[model samples]
Target: MKYIFFVLCWWLAGTLSAQQLKGRVLEAGKDGNVGLPGANVYWLGIPGGVATDVDGNFAIEKRPNGRLIISFVGYASDTLEIGEKDHYIEVVLKAGHQLDEAKVFKRGQTTIMNTKSPVIEQVITGEELCKAACCNLGESFTTNASVDVSYADAVTGAKQIQLLGLNGKYVQMMTENMPNFRGVSVLYGLNYVPGPWMSAISVSKGVGSVTNGYEAIAGQISVDYKKPQGSEKFYVNLYGSDEEMFEFNMNGSIHLNDKWSTALLVHGDWMEKEHSMHHNGFLDMPKKAQYNLMNRWAYKTDAWFVQFGGKFLDENRLGGQKGFREEMRHQIGEGNLYGISINTRRYEGFLKVGYLMPQYENTSMALLVNYTDHDQESYYGGYEYDARQRSLFMNYIYQSIFGNNPNQKFSAGASFNYDNYDEIFGDYKRTENGLVKNTPVNPQREERVGGVFFQYTGTFWTKLTLMAGLRYDYHNLAGGFVTPRFHIAYMPDEMTTLKFSGGKGRRYAAVLAENAYLLASGRSVNVAGQLLSGRPGALKNLDMEEAWNFGVLLNRKFLLFDRLLNINLDYYRTDFSHQVVADNETRPGMINFYNLDGDSYSNCYQVEIRYELIPRFDIMGAYRYNDARITYSAPEGLRRVRTPLQSRYKGLINLSYYTNMKKWQFDFTTQFNGPGRLPGGNQQFESFQLMNAQVTKFFRKWSIYAGCENIGDFTQKHPIIAADAPWSVDFDASRIWGPIHGRKFYVGLRFGFDRD
Candidate 1:
């Protein structure tokens, strides 16, 4: 079977190679030629186009006798005729008409859909990020309809995301195309990246390419940070909220020479005040303090490029009853108050190098290396948990045209992943016959994997595109496996596009770390059979989880009332072959882990529309439906039931308007959440609505914005069961369905200096 699949992939790749046209666009500067980023390049009558990269580099399918057009803001548009012999070209653009006392106005879309790539992708720009109080990555998805962000539990204040009706772990997370936020960091890693340091975010639906890894079962999300060589010289942001939360951020860039540049980013935030707005004895939010820092350096030459960076973070959190403090973590008893405390310190570093081959046209090779060390200590009520992780990753790739055919391109790569973990978890205090006891479980593990992959891309007639990839990996623990992915895109006209994608993905489950929030409850932890009978200190020998995903998308654009209107529709389905299930409903007062023995699947559908109501006024609306189920062991054998705490449907509407001079902006958003079944599928939650709004005023060199969240002040009732008794078996904080806190207001200021 493997040999037949390999032969089929190779045969499909040999049919589509032609020729490609490559070039660079630059602006005529006083000192020298400056590369212009974000320039639009397309054929004169083509259906799709592409934008230049950060270095003003672009590649397109070569068509004989076709006219190519390039244009950018504040620059004159240029058109040129292409010939069969031309493979590379360079063009310089001059400034557009200038008036004596008039200003040139330019506006760009806050969100964009890529029409050229084979994969379905959406880009969120920095302008859209400012619509709300985006203090961290967890809060940046307020305007997006596809990704849903929610709190994991009521006490820890930890946030998690859902994509295609699946958990965040199934969705691969990346920073600048590198894998991150794995293992122990999955719970709180969303809070590490400061919002002020982001430039853009890209979200791709369905399974991604195999070059990254075999872990993207649902989708992929990649974040792009502000570059060191950007036009910004210095920037700062200050924020304060109604809950007495204060934050400060600053970043600056410096150029050492013509070939070297560096940037420094710093962030600090604290919330020392404790509040129990519900008067339920338990605090609504955690008291927290965090400090983060990063430094990056970049070097570029004609044929070589190098970039290196390092980051450090330190954070502390305290939460529980209203009067509980961090100092009372060890004094939990009949007379003492219940408390929760967590402390974390992390370090990360990475290096990337790329080289362009002068001997071959459109050929390049690159290498990437990354290392991370994370340590955490925490205690929930009478339970204690401590963990440490060390991970290293490396990838190398070679890219070039196939047999001098510009229309056919291929890339081959190899990757290595290593991980070491140490964990200790148990209850420090146990009550038995009016006496207290102690029980602890310690488990350690190390993993190593090496993989190689090949990917081929082919384009025909500038309307149809096909991409296929295959990868094989050998794991020390799981033996060997193969992953295959395929994608197809077709454009029927200038305003219509259709895409289909399918792929297979696999990964090992990190049970204890991923479900750390369950510790806040009084439930006991257990394993299904004799997996931990003899080797009590060794980790469970569970099967690696595997799944297949398939999806289809349709995008159309047309004129309505003489204005452009866009509509998008998509559907995806995921089927699991092997899964490690976390069964909390089968047995009351106990959390059990076991291997799956039946069916598990998820189906998702979404529709989105964007239009302009009036000049400078834009509106967007979206709706999504989900059907997810899992099989679990019950008192009467096995049964399939709906997943707990997952909403059946969601609706969103967003409105934005700005003044003519762009000095003032107003934004409003509304969301409707449908009810879902609670644990055991015995009861259903009630539907609710939420509203948010913001207003911003811009000055010459700074801006001020204010916003309010949960304008309706709608919150879930009794989010925590048996809140009055923390040591009782009925106490559970993991069954969260909606907001735990009430309305909140915040104000912020941003100042920046532009480079000449």
Candidate 2:
């Protein structure tokens, strides 16, 4: 009782003495004052900070001895002392253009750390995207060791990403702070955004902010598109591969006066020829074509900011036996020749509005609205599936400093979501009486959710930060529920930082849509489980999945040989109170779906080390381990088992070198993939090693590069099951555990010019 009373008194005293400071950052150009968007601003010796908005405005809590620090790229950093009476100030930075010849530093390959973020966040800049063949968002993680990407199946050529040994679906994906790639998009949306359209990608592991809703179970990925006002006036990229794949992208920006600007982005890719490497009667990769376009507009002033955008995408793919053609797809039921075809179209529109109070520097409000429509039709062997979805999302958030001091910050928000889905599965078949019938495996749903959330952040002694958040949501199907989350960061010294987080997350399982990749095989689909009350249809009684995530992280940086070295270590665990299990091991020719009856969890640990080996040369190494298990109902009743195809361990090493003035560049990466268990047996796959290398030369306004992927020429012997019998019950294409294609060579060129 005494300890509790003392803690309360201390908190009360600290809350009564805090204050907030607001400011604007600009570049002192010779001709005029230029706002520096995305500038970093923070209080000296503090663990939390904020970035300047598009209009170059910022607000942060202040301390008794508060000192302000502001920094921007290509400019000299500035630090200023704050006075008690100073509530708002304007800072100007001078441009610095000094190049170090001996030690060339590249911004894109560097993993920037956000010291102010309560959760460990890593920022990957657009420059990093140039390091690989980054065709789309799914392929952008090739250089990032934290996220693992693999082929979902050999025939359809679908790629999937995993974080902390969990599927990417558990990771909330966002575009400019608004939700994206949920529901139907979860299937193939990873390929929607072209790499050239992105300015940066932010990755945060563990429980993320509750302001984005409770769908995040593993982590969060936020993508930032190139801004219309700051980027180059025009840019173009052209790429081609030895395997007949070609791509083109163009980006252009226009300024409609000082307060209004617009940007247009376009991308297209096509593989005109299909080729087979192993000659197993199946195409090595599917022939695909896609066209994507986006238009974004921005309007900003001293008090109000607005942004709106729209995107459209169309894609088609075909794959199967080497001789199979699109014309043969209609005869799939006859089974003379196997083929697969898919078509998809998507459209999206979003608007964001922000208001900054002129009288109060610490008060602001923001509203976000988004809408999406997606449709897809696909055929795999004798099976056919079609799905369509329409969704709308809106959120309004208000933020301000409360209490006696600025150290007490609060955020309140309300959100609404509506989704409608229509889907059909199965195929036309002939009955025993020789009558043709259209068999339907239907699963349809309509969901409406409204939620309100509040978050509080507190700082103590400038070295410790705490955040507590709660959200109340009403789902038409799941009913009412509350989610609570907490986070803490402590710095024992200037060199070491420790963080901990725990949170609850819930999401509805779109079982069929998410698992459609499984349809490429001959396995029969089964959906038998306890259903929710008062619900009817093919998907009746399916309960929502919920889980709790907890994690701990440690980061330290030291000086060695007059250079800086950084080490990062983290561990995360996930426990599922309820889960929708996709079971493919209990039966030989069937895929079963049911609710979890027992325990299901995952534990992961990772470590990373980075150091500068020499001037203009850097090396980085990382290792990770994952242990994931689940309980399933078998013929002998419920039993715990290891999740199939989950790697037990992984290792990575990267080396990079740059010549004087960064005119020449070289990069190499090697990775080790550990063994994993296969389905329906205790067998495990053999470990494999992969290597990649690239070289590039830069000119004044143009750059050209060449690279080779899978340099070791290593591939799985047989990626398909029962390859000779495509229509047999044993035929399955979803058991891929390694790369199916060997070495691949590609080249690309980029041209961009800066604007005055």
Give me the candidate number with maximum TM-score: 1
The ten-residue window of minimal lDDT in model 1 covers: 97-106
Model 1, 437-523: lDDT tens digits are: 354677888889999999999999978999899999998989999999999988754456778999998988878888888888878
Q: Relative to the true structure, how large is the alpha-carbon lDDT of every model?
A: 0.83, 0.80
Clashing pairs in 2: 18-405, 18-406, 19-406, 531-541, 532-541
Q: On a 0 to 100 scale, what is the lDDT of residue 393 in model 1?
A: 89
Using lDDT, give the best candidate's number.
1
Tens-digit per-residue lDDT, 1-756, candidate 2:
884465446434333323557678898743358765567676655533555644566556655456777865455677898878888889998765433344222332256655555766788777667778788899888778789888888898877779888888888889988888887778677888899889888888877888888898888999999888766789999999898899999999998887899999999999979777877888878899999999999988878889999999999989989878878876643446788888999999999999998888688999999999999988888777788989999999999888557887889999998888898776544345431335566678899999999999888897898988999999999999998988898865444567889999899888877888888787777776522122235675467889999987777655455445667778899999999888877877778888899999999989888776776577889999999999988888897978888789999998888885678889888989999999887899999999988888888788999999999999888888887888766889888888899999999999986665
Candidate 1 — which pairs collide? 18-406, 18-407, 19-406, 19-407, 20-406
